[model samples]
Target chain A: MPGKVVRVRRHSNFGWKERLYLPMIFVGLGVTARHFFENFWGYMIGKVKTFVVQYPEERLDYADAFRGHPVLVALESGAPKCVACGLCEFACPTDCITILPDETRSAIERIPKVFDIDMSRCMFCGLCEEACPEEAIVMSRDVELATYDREAMLFHKEDLLRTEEQLGRRIGFIREEYNRA
Target chain B: MSDLLQAIEEKLGDAVEDSHAYRGDDTILVSHDRVLEVMQTLKDDSSFRFNMLIDLTAVDYLGRDPRFEVVYHLGSVEVEARGSEPSSLRHRLRVKSGVAEVPCEIDSVTSIWPAANWMEREVFDFYGIRFKGHDDMRRILLYEEFQGHPLRKDYPKERRQPLIGPRN
Candidate 1:
């Protein structure tokens, strides 16, 4: 049996002058300079520059319908709006909401005595807010809810229930959504 | 039971307390105490060789009799070689970790299935369930200094004091 062998091809070698490598260096510099100039021009014209909000100093405005942390509402009569029907508790898939009943209020049925919401466990499905029959619970736009301690994440009734005065500018948007047909 | 599953059931008789087949997917509910034996037999037996352990986790059904149920989803990659159709097997072992302090020890399946290490760690991190023979059991998601398991049903929502200083 006969075996076949393949021969390799060799290109022409560069001279001493060509091997100095000044041409390659110039080509590399030209490519880098072109990139630098393009980026600089685009940035100067404000085309490539990003317009991200600085957050703490300059925050991005959230939409009127942006459901965030569920807040307990207070009635105009200076009482808690939550009737403690346990609907919110039942609606919560994670079972983060725990409501303890109070017998003081007659009209509101039961008020949350030790209402605790584990924020860490909350998937924020917005079911609790939607399940509220009395419109007592609403998700706040304030999303900066970072906590150092796990225990700190447990939000009680007092912490979740926002007073009318403390509603801030976000409340106006919420009110607009509430009033919308 | 499908022909393959029936063969498995026949091979591992009495080991499986109850088996559920839904939507062509088979889930065998094994007792917690015999989980190790069941897993060992499933791996060793030629008919139903469940070599791969997919995931392990715990569910806190607070109001139920068994407050905590550790769910283990096992898969058999070697089914194709044993003249059985290729299908993943899920085995959920319900460990009744009682309401207050349920002290029940289920043998670690990690000895046979090495992949159970991370899954068991995750279960421990979230539900506070301990795997007896686990080499390194520590919090995976939360910091080491972090208090109670957040996934537990009783984890509190609010803090006594505000996380930050009062608004200016």
Candidate 2:
């Protein structure tokens, strides 16, 4: 079957008002008015606004469950809470944790000679902290861990181990609990 | 096991350096350059129709000559009977390549397996291994201004402490 071709007639000229450019001007004005009204209404209702937290002055409060950097706890007698059992290191899937053993006077067998937590490789799974039987290693709330050098991100025993005096002034309820603990 | 390895050997020939079938699972080690060709053959060939890429990652053998080995786990989903367990047979292929400051970009498999997008991005993000034709090749987790690749072996963990305060 062959397809049929149809011919169409073309209009010669625009109407009086269309030729005068009034309709075109009205369409342009309508578009401009619509945008202006929308923006004006948004501004009046404070919808089209930018609100940002002053990060330096207004710090965010993290929830109690927020697992941040892992911390090594210190005993009441100023000794590290780690028994140097190497359980945390073994439990770490990424092998980011490294611990060295040292003899301590207390009955608590071995102390970590050198505890290193590679924050770079650490997946922040909280597995190491959970594997700690001595309640020594814990994920702290101090999450501001921006660093320039790769070397600086690998935290050693001294860097991760937190002391009561070092925690400074308490700001939230968790700080009070940490102090009490 | 020998039959499958022999089939791969026949198809890929010299490209695959070594082939090992462990407990009905095949693992073929090949050179970095030949990975794309091998993958394409596996996908197109009738015997081994590995249409899906399960995982793609890189392992940094820091001391080895070709320091990086990109591992690809390929599989095809096979439907089972209603009462039976659905199974998938996966083949792991490791391609050895040089890892230096000059980035090593592998031919991306996202065209074959769309799921490789995030996995490749993750590998690139953590290991700094580049995928040549990735649509958006940017850091997934880390901030844009982040400095060094943290997963590299030499990255230190101590110097991040503030000078005046006690280290946390």
Candidate 3:
């Protein structure tokens, strides 16, 4: 006995009715008109209920759990709390993180001399945040990361460091989740 | 093992061997020479119409006689009531002829089922297993210029291939 052969033929009908798509066109126009008139009427009545907003001037409120870019946690002492363990670099599935451990540490035992994250390669998976032993690296809600050059997309340690004030919403969200758990 | 193994053995005597059921899964280990025949029989036979090829992969056992084991998961579309849910009877099969590491070769099953082409290519790409009758036998996962089989046990972990950008 042999394996059975499966034959599947596709039947597509492109008749005259399909060519004259006036009915479908009218149906689509009707839906658009209904939306336009409803939105216009709502605006005239001072309802202030429209789907589209004036972008660049206003933005929707994002959830606290939103994952965007990874940022270094800055301590109250004006120093980043990262221990330069290179765990984030190792744990990065896309290999976007690069942490060069500080060889010359006068007071601190270990810190990153050069911490680089190529934003182009990053998938925003939040694996680095999970890999952080000291909670030094966490995901930020700053998703507006457009740049003119590729070199600008490669964030350095200085650019990535964010104070507790900057990450207040996310820190509180994470703390609340931990407390609940 | 659902009487299917015994029926398969009766149909293709020496081709099927070391078949047993574990955790409700019926797994059969077959010799490499008659693997294509065994797969065809399993698919065409009315009693065991395992038409769907779920997956095909190869496992490298370092410091072993065969060095590599090819795994094939087959499923039949015939649905039957099992408790409250309907389920297909899927069978897992493993085959090995114990070839040397120099040129790991096995007869391709693409003649029976065309779905094995890409799968065989992937196995060849990762484990360096050569399928004799495969029409297009190229690296499916890795670049053509990739130095060595990454999944092989002997392949080094830290061996660096310097490129324009950083390592993946």
Candidate 4:
């Protein structure tokens, strides 16, 4: 269907109501005034609830399924839980993840000597999290990752690492998802 | 053998190399040389008017002798409004033809259904399977300077190309 051309009708002539503009303008203003009055009255009575959070001052808790960005799960010892299997790297469609596996003296046998994720290239599709065999990589609620510097966006292994406690919600959600599947 | 497949086989005869109704999907394997003729017949045939070209793609079997197989999914819509007993029926058929590795080209169905234009281009882009008689054949997904067909089994997955255009 990609080759099919859909012709949408464009209205060049404005109707009398649109051309007059004053009546429609009043209608729009009436809508605004209605909302303002309703909100003001509700606020005065302290019965109205708001959808907006005070952003920086008050952070809204994201749901467990809300995928923000990929992060490496770290153990209590500060070492990454990842064994450098490279499944996540391979699963990444955008090739944003880069990993260099090295022999580790730990029982895991291997660890990523260098792991970098170019945030600019990362689409936050959570394919890396799904492909992780050890559940070492997961999507965290770290949505506010805007940076002024391009270099800052290229997150190193250290920058991507989050402790188990910090990622408890996501881990639980993943476990539940896998269990259901 | 489905009735549809039987009809197709009877209509096309020697052009149809093999056919099967594997699972529920009715598929007919046609000779690459006679693909355009087969497609035209399928589209124009009154009993099996496959008016819509649903999907067009190619598969690469690395070790296979032919190496590439272009697949086409054709769909037909039927409206049976006979004296208040109104009903609509739909039928689907899969057509596949093997293309040799040396001359990896197959006849384009674009002349019959214009929807095959970009799909043929995409097949050409990723699998390096050119569609014969396709106008303005160029890379659909990748850049023009892209070295190899990425979907080909022989193409290295991790192979990175030099940055083109400008580097910020």
Q: For model 4 chain B, where is the 10-residue window of minimal lDDT?
A: B80-89
Question: What's the CA error at residue B88 for candidate 3, in Å?
Answer: 4.1
Question: Which of the numbered candidates is closest to the native, going by highest lDDT?
Answer: 4
Total backbone clashes of model 4? 0
Q: Which candidate is the best by DockQ?
A: 3
Q: What is the lDDT of residue B9 in candidate 4?
A: 89
Per-residue accuracy of model 4 over B72-143 as CA lDDT, tens digit each: 999996554444443344689999999999888888888999999999999999999988899979998998
**Model 4, stretches more than 4 Å misplaced?**
A1-28, A43-54, A68-139, A148-181, B79-89, B166-168
- lDDT by residue (A83-163, candidate 4, tens digit) is 888999999999999999899787888889999999999999999988899999999998888889999999999999999
What TM-score would each prediction reach against the true structure?
0.47, 0.46, 0.75, 0.73
Give the best candidate by TM-score. 3
DockQ head-to-head 1 vs 2, winner: 1
- What is the lDDT ranking, best to worst? 4, 3, 2, 1
What is the lDDT, from 0 to 100, of the residue B87 in candidate 1?
Answer: 38
Ranking by DockQ: 3, 4, 1, 2
Over 4 Å off in model 1, which ranges?
Answer: A1-43, A46-48, A68-125, A143-181, B14-18, B22-25, B29-38, B44-47, B57-71, B78-108, B117-168
Q: Tell me the spans in candidate 2 whose CA falls farther than 4 Å from its real position.
A: A1-181, B21-25, B79-103, B157-168
Q: What is the DockQ of candidate 1?
A: 0.05
Better of 1 and 4 by lDDT: 4
State the lDDT of candidate 2 residue by residue for B1-168, as single tens digits.
577678888988899887787776677887766677888888888788787787787877777766677788777555443333335454444333344445566777787778889888887887788887789888888655556666666666543622354435
Model 3 agreement with the true structure over B1-168: per-residue lDDT tens digits: 667667777888877767777766667878877787888888888877787787888888999877888888877765664554445455544333444576788889898778899999999998899999998999998877788888899998888754545447
Instruction: Kindly report which residue pairs in candidate 3 clash with one another.
Output: none
Candidate scoring better on lDDT of 3 and 4 = 4
